[model samples]
Target: MKTVLVIEDDIGIQKQLKWSLTDYELVFAQDRSSALTQLRRYEPDVVTLDLGLPPDPANASEGLACLNDILSLQPECKVIVITGNTDNEHALKAIALGAYDYYQKPVDADVLNIIIARAFKISDLEAENRALKSANVGNTDIIGNSESILKAYRTVEKIAPTEITTLLLGESGTGKEVFARAIHRQSPRVNKPFVAINCASIPENLLESELFGYEKGAFTGANKTTLGKIECANGGTLLLDEIGDMPLSLQAKMLRFLQERVIERVGGRQELEVDVRVICATHRNLAEMVAEQSFREDLYYRISEITLNIPSLRQRGHDIVIIGKALLHKFNQEFNTQVQGFTDSAMQSMLHYAWPGNIRELQNKLKSAVILADSKYITEEDLGLSARNAKVDTLRKVREVAETQAIRHAYTLATGNLSKTADSLGITRPTLYALIDKYRLHDLRNTETEN
Candidate 1:
């Protein structure tokens, strides 16, 4: 049974509510303090708050403050405000303060129960949606279907099941961390923690302590013994994001940990064993760094046992549009906008533009467009892409580009099945084969035989 917190001070009404709302498991509180106590203890999804809460039942001040406290403690809780028949002002104020709904006093048990039911239903749905979104965050967040992305996906599929220390090579904002999470989700260590630390983001002086942790009295202000990222991720995965930016002084300790699967806290001499699958990602050229003597050669070889090079957005062909559309949909839901789709000009501009920041750039542009777009479809101006900046294409060139995009999109949707791709494109197998050969799509053709 779902739980409901009833915060009313009146004895007669409280008794009436208890008798009427028999369908739910109800917890009663006569004042603000007790309501908060019950709220924390039960963590009920639905709350029916009385505007005449004790210590000042004549004025709505105490009740409103209680409502504020309840929302601050649990923002998702559905707070139904009970008000006097003439208390429209307080009711509106309650709604503005994030109360779910309001009920007028001289309560009709049936009517109040209906409102409470609706609140519970909506709360359940929001919780369910949040749960689903969280479940998909690690697995389905990497959205792409282009051959380059597919190849990366295939590589992840092969390496995710193993304990090999994987290195993800990609341009910044190419979602190296997303790929890292994907690997962790697919691996046997899926149930365990996946801790990530950015070497560049943290100061060089603190990077070692952040990775290996420090003990109490290990250094100044070290009040308590703490577990490092590696120790926290024991039996799971640790992503050393931007590993290339790690300071030379700390690289030796990292190398030792990687080779021996052991780490020593800064203040402590104990060698703690950690069995974590390490994944390193960076935009820098490690080989060049090694040659330049900035990065250790032994550390380079240890992390790069298996390397997956993530393709830049410009190189992913039609995937730019695919990723853009997915992001647009996500932003629409997030911003509560009714954006149908992108305008033709916007679509073309996204396809032709050089996305220097890759998926991160695409996500930001779409988020802004979804919020600021006035019309049913988002325009190029909304995406902040100027027409003057777009490369002009001849009529024939435009036609060829459209055809190529269609074929590739259909081919990806069909999962490289030749017959399915041909049928989806409204062309015969022979014509599809000829077009594939004409376009020199060797990757698609090579993979099609396996399908």
Candidate 2:
């Protein structure tokens, strides 16, 4: 339930306020000291405070101080100020001091409730907007179309229909979270939240509370009750990234959560049943970890009802050019720069280079080149890979890279008409056809023929 704090000193007013807001978990604090304690303890999302208090009942000073403290400590907290009918100026001052809204007395429960409800609605909308932005704003988050990635996507499509526990296997920076989201997007719980937490990022001691949450007084710093990533993702998807690094002790608890679909806060006895789909990703080899007795064997089997392995960019070959072009187009639209195309040297350089950092590194390199390249046609020098030689290149291989990129660039520049793509490259249509055949660039042909 949404929680609200009322910091009014008037006995009759407080009673009416609490009784009116029965839908919320309302907590009352009569004085500044108690109010601050409750503010820290409850961490209520919406708060109603009176400008008059015990120490300074005739003045708005104490109330303004409380507002500043609450705003400073919890910037996201929404504070509504209550003031006497004669204290209109003080109420306006409260608004200047970062108050969410002001209510002038005599207290009208209906009007106040409307304002409070609107504040909560605004809070929820902001949170939802942030999630939408993260999930859909940019392709930079993760990208793939190679068979390996496509295979993983297909697995996600199939597994998302069921509540089966899924394990994603890949090296770091392979966009494991991206694949996890695809599962969430395809799942029955698509409309719900998709919460993710990195197991390896948090400290071992803190990871438990972060995943399952903790009640007030659960730990030294457990000032307020919190819904952990798992609980927060209820009726949706919860992704545990880098689960291989999840401590062995917590592994048992995680197994129990998966088995029962329930979790207990760190120091709370009650079991909270959560209806969430669990998806986990890790770089470590679980089989190897199990063999070494570092990972729980039973837990491994539980989470791995299905597994998808995301391949590195090196394994995908010339798909790098396909992705690079896509990225170039993305940046071209975003930055509104007129980059005609990649130069011959840059195109071959991209084909021959080994992308050790996978697609992420490729993205970073392209973003850098996009910002730095002086010409409409970015060259090998702009990519900063001119010094890196291809590990092994046959004579036919060297010629093939130039011809393939030449055909692709020509096709793209011509908007994919084969005759135009061919003429633009200063080659006869038949010669271009042979080169296209030799290079196995079918997608380019599709576009060319379509145009």
Best by TM-score: 1
- Evaluated against the true structure, the overall lDDT of model 1 is 0.89
Residue-pair clashes per prediction, in order, are 0, 0
TM agreement with the true structure for every prediction:
0.58, 0.55
lDDT of 2 by residue, 1-451 (tens): 6889999888998788778887788999988889989999888889999988889999988889888888988888889998888888998999888888998988887898899999997776565444434433223344545566566666766787888888998877677888888778777898999999999999998999999999999989889999889999989999999999999999999999999999999899999899989898999999999999999999999999988888877776656766777678788888887776677678788878777777788889988889888988788888888735645575568888888777777787888789988778888889888888878887766665545
Computed on alpha carbons, the lDDT of every model, listed in order, comes to: 0.89, 0.83
Clashing pairs in 1: none
State in Å the error of residue 410, model 2: 41
Q: Give the TM-score of candidate 1.
A: 0.58
Model 2, CA-based lDDT: 0.83
The parts of candidate 2 lying over 4 Å away from their true place are 1-144, 333-336, 387-451
Expressed as tens digits, the lDDT of each residue in 1-451 for candidate 1 is 6789999989898899989999998899999999999999899999999998779999899999999999999999999999999999999999999999999979899998899999987996686455444433336577766778888888998999999999999999999999999999999999999999999999988888899999999989999999899999999999999999999999999999999999999998899999999999999999999999999999999999999999999998867876776676677788788897777789888888888999899888999889999899899999998655566676668877888899999988998898999999899999988988877777887788545
RMSD of 1: 20.6
Clashing pairs in model 2? Answer: none
